[model samples]
Target: MIAGISVAVAVLAGCGPLPELDGDPTAGKDGGAKSDSETGRGVNPLDNPDGTGPGLKVISSDKDRAKARDLIDKVATKGRGAKTGYDRDEFGYAWADSVDDVPWGRNGCDTRNDLLKRDGRDIKYRSGSNCVIASMTLYDPYTGKTIDWTKSKASEVQIDHVMPLSYDWQMGASRWSESKRKQIANDPLNLIPVDGSTNGSKSDSGPATWLPPRRDIRCSYAVRFAQVALKYDLPVTSADKAAMLEQCA
Candidate 1:
């Protein structure tokens, strides 16, 4: 028995602090969460395959860009289909965590709160509750701005579907089983918190038609778009793929 000196036990031996990782129900997408530089407000898309990390960081390195290209190249292309009979409700009610079909599901928090906590800085949780976000500073990757957001003006921060549900519908998700559609709708890999106006502008447009206004983040955003597409085996339009590649190029 040792005296007052406390032991510094390691989760793993001879190693530094571990990177936070996410759990996945899907095979092999689970991996370490990568944090960005001093602000620690974002994550690199290349290191966060599971899409559980906060949001995109500027992809400045050529090597990482090439890797992003390789990933993007793997995504198949197809002409987008019709929007007839398309309905948002087909994907599931927004941010319901009623089941364990996807990562962070049924974890005693709704998907919206989970995302806010994941990406927000200086977070203030509601009194006596950790899951309900009362206020936070959000770095909006889409607009190159930081939003001082609070629950009072909730719409100021919008959770965007990287692969929008309507776009997904036109890209063969119209035929997907109901549960699979919900998983894609709420999956962190497909979701991002961005400026409300920017997200609203995006609507259901693909990369060719819309992208983040912040130039440096485009490449990382493309990689995340591809990550979601590949994970769900969803295809982007030929034009969308070209636009995604152009960002990394």
Candidate 2:
């Protein structure tokens, strides 16, 4: 990852786009931390402020995604060491499946509120609800930018599965106990709130085939991707491993 200071320099040098500052200047960065403008919350990090010249762009293709998914499934079945399946619990279904039924949960996690809490700036719990996150600021780690958390624009930022669940589906997860599957689905280590456009572009892609548009982030992204795959015992395409090694080195 780029040092926080280097990120600030990227923004100042017009290397990247300036993030939208949508919350109180007093509120801190990263959604929950206390804010101070002097600490660089409102800064831009791109080498090009105008967003010209090789800005971040995710590759797109349904065909490639399908191939990736198939590759994951094949490797997962042939590979050993992954949890065979998710363990079921008293809830009568997998953790991920149960959360789907929760009134407030969305997208595999108690997603709506989980993200609200994770992304909101001066977030408040919805009235009388501990499970609900009322509001908070969103700091997009992918681009080193911040955004306001108004309901209208909420979709602009989404909680991305750093290692996509679909990718898991084809991998060892297909054989996982539903309960274990749920844990991976909801695990904080597997999630991040990033720009919707970026997340869509990344859909189910691995390190070798895809990466964040922010050039400064390749190292950290590679590290995180490796850690997650290793943790879950997920299989990686040879290209994926190579991509991660190249970036991390």
Candidate 3:
């Protein structure tokens, strides 16, 4: 029941150039198989309009940065609302696979696994189940490092909602239907796999308060934040929008 297309497998084949490493544990191993930046990792947000690809690639060109800024400019801005009635449950159970109207909905795999499969390279599935990811090599765009991940050490890698759920709640999702809320929550366009600690630190903060620690990826991250806001007809706090623009500036 996994919906949409199967997770892109090019990552396993090392689709693109390897990212430069500085003390990356997975670096220099197996001739840098683990460091491969392929499989759409580091994809420009402009090229990846739907967000079903791998990691956020750095937007380095002047033209691309201008494009990123243009996208960020289109995102409407307002003050974030109070979190008066927000709750995780308001968007359906975390990672529920049965939610309707999202890319991977009813796909027989939970959101977490779908994302893990989407972003991880050399992915291994549990015995007799393609839906459960046993292990994989993940290039964490947030930190610009590669991770050799296994289910047993699950916290080492965590799925990040590029537009966090609580932030969404404050930014107009509070008035959305249950189904629409669920769609935004599960949408691949809004998710990425990154270091667990980094994800934790982001904790509901928008671009103004937090961003990926890796400076090179900031422009791409800003584009992603704006993309999600535009897709859902949500507005960011003026401060958040300004911070997003600064990343590309």
Candidate 4:
């Protein structure tokens, strides 16, 4: 579960061994993207429909917020259900790339490294393997902190699920197919690499109960939650939907 970054215990859920890659990891991939700080401030969700784009940038414009609200309004809502029969394993072995219909799925690298490459710049890989990211400079949207993180202290940077799985279960995902669970679990659109401590604090919370500490990033965060909900045809709680709408308003 290298794709499975945790706030506590510092271990991926069901993490598998790192894969070995030939030649340069970025060589001839992603339109000849450089190894430097290539993804400037990230991409706005409104323009990044497929989520092949890197990073989650803030939604600042009035027009974008208007569009965000419109997008959010499409989300269905109901009161949350009981959290019975919920488990991490329900999401398909935590970030297994063997799953399909996802952006970076079966791309030879795991979901976690794919996201690290997508969001982090000034990247470095494990000694000989181009697939394992050893270190990178991450611009954490949640806390507005730039972390120069190394795999030696892998827990320092965590991949957060914008709409947490537990929250999803309480909403309606408990009944979804196993593949759908894995899709949401590893989808880049629903993932963000942020300060580990901040991610730890946000464990399984929705917009109503928790949001990014950085106020400016909240609207974008809200829009992302809505995007995930609508894309999966999942419903959010009514209170959660209200809080999400408030951030953009």
Candidate 5:
């Protein structure tokens, strides 16, 4: 009887194993991409679409989703059989540099810029700076709103965790190693750039409570949520499972 949308806990658990501050964070796989171009509308055009190309094939089947739901149920109740140690009360959380004691790179490609470059078409660098992207063109599938990804205006669009980090932390990520956390933070399986307003409205929430306002992308969003959680071994709350069954089915 896991209560609340609580998708954030699931999201944190999934990416928790990825070392948050890798020597080359951008070197890891990217999440947004497309399997094929159907009238130039079906491609996500990033790096990796949650370990697969962005297409109908990317969508999980009932069997895969059911497996994911089962895993979630196992760990969703917290206490006793919690999946990861990071979820324990004694577990301490810290930012990458402090926890790992690794020097940060000046020109390090961050997830934000990497995503901007990947999702933004004809992207422009903000300056001569290494990965400071300045502008891009975004085709919003959710509300049919077209946005220009510009340094000044692009904050309007934000990179959202299809599954949120905070939620995942509670599910089973609080006990992971530092390097693993970095990897979790940078994994392409858990991120998507969406409308800033929409993202804010959906902050750290899951299908049961917060979903994309635009009905068009709800199915896509649900599939992605399942994929990332399944990839990272995160658990889903009961409410989350029900929402996916109703919306993604």
Candidate 6:
């Protein structure tokens, strides 16, 4: 969680302005970048191997689809475990910045704000703190919509775990160390900013259970899921893996 403005100001006074990014200054608030346009939000998964760039773009070309399939093939498959004892706190507090060994961790900013800064355009920091986001225009890839979000209406936008934490637990994270779990929880490679309701509907489901509402981005979404799983050496269910492959097929 980000500290409130007054509390964060002194600690983050010199944190500096948000990093400069190359994006359209005049893109409409509802559509920050076109789905096919190579400008603001269309970040190819192959190009953004680290998941530090903007929203996932469609993998439309035959060549890119083949690459996505190959990546998906490398992921192992397994049966999901019982969801008997899983809890969010098991991974650490929500968006803790102090988690060791993940990008943007221990950087004086919470994981939520780090993602907001990564995906939101025209971002506005809180009055006296660069670590808290006050408002921004976000291109939500889950539903292919743009949202002008403010801290006041925080739930309108949510940071989604691409491979959700609970799903991770069911697959194999249940046996991992607390530190490794925390790393997966806060890692940018496993996160994406999307519409809150859409994310709620997903609710730890694997690709077989849910996919992005935007048909065009489903293939890219699968590729991202595979990337996160492969990074953590996690496996999806056989059904989930098949559904992921079908998206690109």
How do the predictions measure up, each by TM-score? Answer: 0.84, 0.57, 0.85, 0.84, 0.62, 0.85
> Least lDDT summed over 10 consecutive residues: which range in candidate 4?
1-10
Instruction: Give the runs in model 6 whose Cα sits over 4 Å from its true position.
Output: 1-39
Report the error of model 6 at residue 34, Å.
6.5
> Model 5, 67-171: lDDT tens per residue?
444434343332222334343223223112222322231236666666555455566775677678888666444333446767888668887767777667766
Per-model root-mean-square deviation over C-alphas: 13.1, 12.8, 8.8, 10.3, 12.2, 11.1
| lDDT (Cα, 0-100) at 70 in candidate 6 | 95
lDDT of 4 by residue, 177-226 (tens): 98889999999889988888878977887787787766666788888899
Alpha-carbon runs more than 4 Å astray in model 4: 1-39
Residue 249's lDDT in candidate 4: 95
Our model 5 lands, by Cα RMSD against the true structure, at 12.2
lDDT string, candidate 3, 195-218, tens digits: 787688788988877877666677
Better of 1 and 3 by lDDT: 3
Q: After superposition, how far is residue 52 of candidate 6 from its true place, in Å?
A: 1.0
lDDT at 164 for candidate 6?
Answer: 92
- Which of 3 and 4 is ahead in lDDT? 3
Question: Local error of candidate 4 at 46, Å?
Answer: 1.0
C-alpha RMSD in Å of predicted model 4 compared with the true structure: 10.3
Model 2: residues with Cα > 4 Å off, grouped in runs: 1-112
Worst 10 residues of 6 by lDDT: 2-11
